[model samples]
Target: MNLGTYLTRSARYWPDETVLVCGERTWSYRQLDCRTNQLAAALIGRGLRPGDAVASLAWNRGELVETEFALYKAGLMRAPVNARLGRGEITHILRYAPVRVLVFDAAHREDALAAIAAAGTDCLPVPLDDVPGDDVPGDDAPSDEIPAAGPVGVPYADLLAEGTGDPVAVEVDEDEPCVLNFTSGSTGALKAAVQTFGNRLANMRKQLMSDESRPRPGTRYLACGPITHATGMGLLAGVFGGSTTHVLPAWSPEAFLETVEKERITATFLVPAMLTMVLAHPGAADRDLSSLTSLRIGGAPIAPQRLREAVALFGPIVAQGYGLGETTSVVAGLTGQDIARAVTEDPELLQSCGRAAYDTEIRVVDEAGRELGPREVGEVIVRGPDCVREYWQEPELSAETFKDGWVHTGDLAWMREDGYLFLVDRKKDMIISGGFNIYCTEVEAALYEHPAVREACVVGVPDERWGEAVKAVVVTHEGRAVTPGELIEFCAGRLDRYKKPRSVEFVPELPHNRNGKLDRKAVREPYWADAARRVN
Candidate 1:
């Protein structure tokens, strides 16, 4: 079934049930379904056809959710742009996707218009400010003028009101593409990954069946991250299971906790860094987080100590998962039982990302793509229905990324005898010194064991003799100080001499990408600015 069918089914089963909650506003499934149908009829009235692309530049709100269902009903692919990106980046995605119509909320209207202008594409803009807001932002604010670009200009409300005489019936195949998600590439380009209806359905099924993935009706889901990423789309899985979503326009440690207490949020997904920020917030101690039942975290590995502290503060609700944009969301998850085992029995297992999902098959393979034995570190490859078949418009890269039937994740990991998978580091993040491969995560894990260290990122810097030397960027706890020599000594005691960082730089914090992963590209770009090749 298509992703849009979920709305129809929910509307049928629980028509009057509240489906979405944005701040003080709430939308029933019946209201949402009817409104989206009207919006779809509006899009059809404007000449949008099957397979046409509809892009939206907006934050998490009722309108954004409406546009998703509307585009699905219209049989058009929805391409949600990353609102955090600059105009140039947005322009590249729009040009690459070549969308037929673009929708922008009032907050992002200027950037969306700028991106369309830069791409030299004629797009019909739907001004969300003109729509009747209900307890959400712009509820009582004056309607702002939305600059017109195309001849057919209509307010979002007026278009919804002028519904078509009959809903146009369109054939939708389960394998048809429904969403286009763009990922940052190694060469600084955007790689659009097409998510099929079947892929999304498979993800929803897997998540709904998992014992640790339960979200009851009326459960409040807090979405604080960028909706363009995989985590953002994964939040929809919660909605599919009959939960209400609460959106945060932006990330703020104080606001995150306040919303949790105020909204009585039951579940949320955050990256490790964002979780750390929430824990460090002064208001966190004062907030009542007893309502939370599940806190799914991923995007990066969580330190053991940090995991312990999170469990201490939030109860045993924080679960970790491992996956990438190409996987359509989660491939492996550390469930509540796994968390309990790690905390009560074996603390070392807390560092692992647990086993593969029920629908996924994971294996560690060598350089020649040969399957490796347990405890042997190699490339982590996975094959499943949820995995993407190929990257859009890149035959060569697609061939290299997908071999045989497995999708090469480019992440180095090893499986234990108990079937748990432990992520070492990214293949590119491994530091090679005098032909010896050193995983950055190993060094960082050791560094985090230091009492004074709060966070650490390790990368290979250019060296004249060793080809590449280990370098670390560290963030210390408040009122704590660790000299470079002292940290180097700390690593020397726990790790091999070659694995120890030759230099250490203490900084306030490390830079993170939109998905909350360490921005190693940004960190290494400056050091290798004049280098001939990225590799020494």
Candidate 2:
């Protein structure tokens, strides 16, 4: 079975309905389907085999979306390198996958050429012009503007123009690799979670089945982050549900607000950092966002206070999910109603990421693989159809992370009696002070309660007496101010004496990984630079 078949079916059902929108370009179901078929045929006709690797290195655009479906139709492995990656990292990915073709936007052309040269591979480049109205034969009387060309590589439009517009059908096994899901390398060298066709199919199904954030007819899904990563995962379900996808070329608060207001977007996804920016944007109060139905946040844990602010501004439409690249879909979700209920009835539920989602099995396990009971913090492990079993080519590393049938997430969390997962901190990020354990998230949660604090990152610093002490790096709202001593005192009231931050430092901003999660590893580096061991 192939996933592209679903798109073919959607086109049959909603031929004239808009399926994709990026910038000023909009592709109807029929147009997108025909163009993808042409793309698939072009690739296969150009000597690409079923299992050959194809990569896209670009910012959010219609071309990347087209490439994703085209690869599925052609039975090729989709390796999407984050556009924010450096030249060296890009080279590593191209050489590691040895991608036969690299499709990129004009913005990344120079870096793409350098990576190809450095990798010393026969990787052909496909330059996408991103001409807003360029179209296939049956699309809008055919664009008079030709597909843009560069000094090296094929023109993206030329390949589409060559297609017969007939469907490109390929036989593919469900368990075969479909995507090389790479991490942002916040912890170390980038690693890919090899997700299979079956894994992604299940991911699509999980979203469709759940009542939490299911896409339905007339659903307008707006992706505010890079379509190559987490926010883009929702596209699969949206496509299957015949929803129109709106892709933001880049993220800015004004752009997001304007698009949502203009398109009357029903659903959208944002990472915590993006949400923080949106909540802080001055004009957000004036935007006509009443049409919004779902505001899903992920890619990082958001402070509950920030979540509350989101609900206040967005009218209780805010929700969140917990998952990673290894888990191809959300393993758990905190629904909008759940957040609302927390505000009224169950205040503590705001701290929870919600119960195990759908068919996923989650456990907080000890070192011996024994499941811990309620309130017992341990490693969070998940097993399900959506959970990936291995990395692309790193067997040893794969074995270390994936054991038995469970993906051992290094996150430290505990389960409540009702099965909700409450993450304390990442195992590595937890600070041990004089044999007393301190979860950075717990301390940060306290700091977020202060009215002046806007963003906070907690880390461990070396201390002669306690071995390690908790340090809080904070960013306050632009017009708000709070002294370090006052903030420390505020936290002292909410947390245990041992759990309270020993010191606080005000900063203009906190470092965020390309995926938009707070970069805790970067925040801790300076404090641990002179330590005998990075982690005490």
Candidate 3:
């Protein structure tokens, strides 16, 4: 069935139920459905067809969600661009995707128009601010919302309001593409991973049935991250199960905590960096978070100490989800049981992402693609219904990514005897020193155990003597101090001599990509600028 049908079905069953909440505005399922239908008719009138692409450059807001449903209803593939990107980067994506229609919020109007002009693509800009924000109440006057300063061609409200005809019926195959999500190119250039309706449905089913995955009816979910990313798309799991989504336009430690208490949010997903900021916030101690049922975190590994502190502050509902854009959001999730296991049996287990989800087959394979046994490190390969079949318009890359029947994750990992999978590092991120392979994650994990270290990232730098040398970038706890010698000594006690970092650099925070994953490439680029290639 088409994904649009999911919204229609839900609307029919629970017409008056709150479907979306942003600030003070709330939209019932029926109201949302009608708006999407009107927007879909408008899109069709504008010449959008099945398989045509429509892109949105916006944050997590009510209008963004409305555009998604409208695109689905119109049978157009939705491509939500990362608003953080500059004009050049945005232009490249528009040129690559060749979308027919582009939507932009006031905040990103300049970049969107610049991208459209640079790409020379036929794109109609739909200003988001002019759209009605009259669902519930509480925010500033809606009349004050002006068209974001750019080439304002059409107002989204005008288009929706002008189209008063009945919604057109569009037939969509289950295998038909629904969304196009771009990968955060931390290691290489970004590629669009096309996700199908069937893939999303399968992923949602796995999450809902998982022993640790549960969201009560009318649960409030605060979306503070970029909705254009996989983590944002994963919020559909909450929507499918009947939960209200509260959107935070941007990430702010103070605002995030305040929203949680004010909205009585039951669940929210955050990256490790965001979590660190929330914990560091001055008001965090006074915030009432008893209503939170789950604090979902992923995109990077969490330090054991940080995990402990999060549990201490928010109870045991901390959930870790493991996946990529290619996995359509979640491949494996560390549930409450998994967190409890980490607290009791082996805290180190918390460092490892939980076992593969039901319906997913995970295998660690050697360089020749030979399957490895438990405790043996190799590239993690996943074969599941949720896995993307191919990258958009890149047949050669698709072949390299998908081999036999499993999708090569390019991530190095090992499985324990208990069936838990431990991520070591990205294969590209692995540092080779003196012909010895050292996984950055292993070294980072060891460094994170230090009392003074709040966050750590490891990368390899060029060394004339050793061919490559390990380097550590650390973020120390507030008011705490640690010298480079002390950090090296700390790692020496936990890691092998060669595996330990040869140099340590203390920084306030490590650089992160748009998706919130540690940008090892950015961290190592300066040191490897004169080298032949960034990696060995």
Candidate 4:
């Protein structure tokens, strides 16, 4: 059955219950079900087929949630481009994925248009605005039926109205690609994790079964981060379990606290950075956050100290999980009780990211893929139904990552005898700052574009608010002359704002190995010398 069958079931069970809330707007289970059915029908009407891709570029909103389910019903791949990514990266994603329809809001109007032009694809733009619906694009695109359109393409409302308000029961194989999860690779190239329909079904099962992330009836889940990423993972589970999902249009500490109090949000997920900000917010103490039952944290390795501080402020509701894009759902989790135990009896457990969750099998392995004994540090590999089997269009990378039926997550960690995972270092050439993955080579490529930058090494430095901050060490060309601010701005223009270096340092010389290759580890050593763990 399609994943959207759950939504239809929910609407039948609780049609009048609020299923989604975004600011002043609220969507009941009936509204969401019918609207998603209509949207799914509309996309199919426009000639989109199962396995064909549809990408969305917008901030967190009810429509993104709607689009997710609609795509599920249509059996289309939901390719959600990160709203924070720059124009170039956006173009790279547009070109990389087989995206046939690009849905975006006004905030990203110029960038979306420019990316389409640069990508040179026949992707029809579906703007989320009430523009005049005439002379739409894609009228001749081999379809028996076409929706009413505007100058750019079909306006979002017009497209929805164009949809027949009937359930679209498109049959699809479980192995079909469901989502194109795009990420910047260490090679400075963009790649997408092809999350299969089976992977998503397994994900839903995990969420429904896991104690840490399970949504309960009458519970409201506040998404405190971008819905395109981790925070949005809970939407389907919320609907399945009859929970109302409250979306934060834009995340702020004040907004988060207020929403929880106003909506009485029972469960939510936040990255370490958002948790840090909320903990440090002055009004946090004044807010009535007693309604929150689960405040699950993930996206990056959160400091044990922050976990304790949060428990003191928010009671014993703090939890943690560890997973990645390749793993559609968290394979390991630290529950609230475990955190409470860590605070009281087991201090060491606080440093661990729980044990293997549900059916997921996590192992610490040597270079030869041999499973290491307890307390032995090695690469972490995972095998589970929810894990992705391939990268979109990259067989070599797929072979390297998804080998022998296990996804080799490039995180070096050890497993306790009891199965808790303690991440010690990152084996990949990447950094996680504020929960966003930034590869060193990806940033270095941007810095190299500057005329004065002879050599550049990007690393993550210890940060208070963010788990880690992007730092750049540069060796300038002789007499070329460039200020740190200028170099930083240059990268900001070329890359995403979050991926740009927070601080830049000039060095006369950079460390190199005997083979004459730049020693990235040596450049990272100084910044992490005082730290306890290699990764934050």
- Report residue 441 deviation for candidate 4 (angstroms): 21
Top TM-score hit: 2
lDDT of 2 by residue, 156-187 (tens): 98877867789887889988899999884444
Cα shift from native, residue 426, model 4 (Å): 0.4
Clashing pairs in 3: none
TM-scores for candidates 1 onward, in order: 0.92, 0.95, 0.93, 0.79
In model 1, which regions exceed 4 Å deviation? 130-153, 164-169, 531-536
The sequence of per-residue lDDT tens digits that candidate 3 reaches over residues 485-511 is 999988999989889888998887788
Model 4, range 20-93, lDDT digits (tens) per residue? Answer: 98877899999999999999999999899986899998777789999999998898999998776778888888
TM-score of 1: 0.92
Tell me the whole-model lDDT of each prediction, alpha carbons only. 0.79, 0.87, 0.79, 0.83
Ranked by TM-score, top first: 2, 3, 1, 4
| Model 4 TM-score relative to the real fold | 0.79
Error of 4 at 338 (Å): 0.5
In Å, residue 75's CA in model 3 sits off its true spot by 1.5
What ranking of all candidate models by lDDT puts the best one first? 2, 4, 3, 1
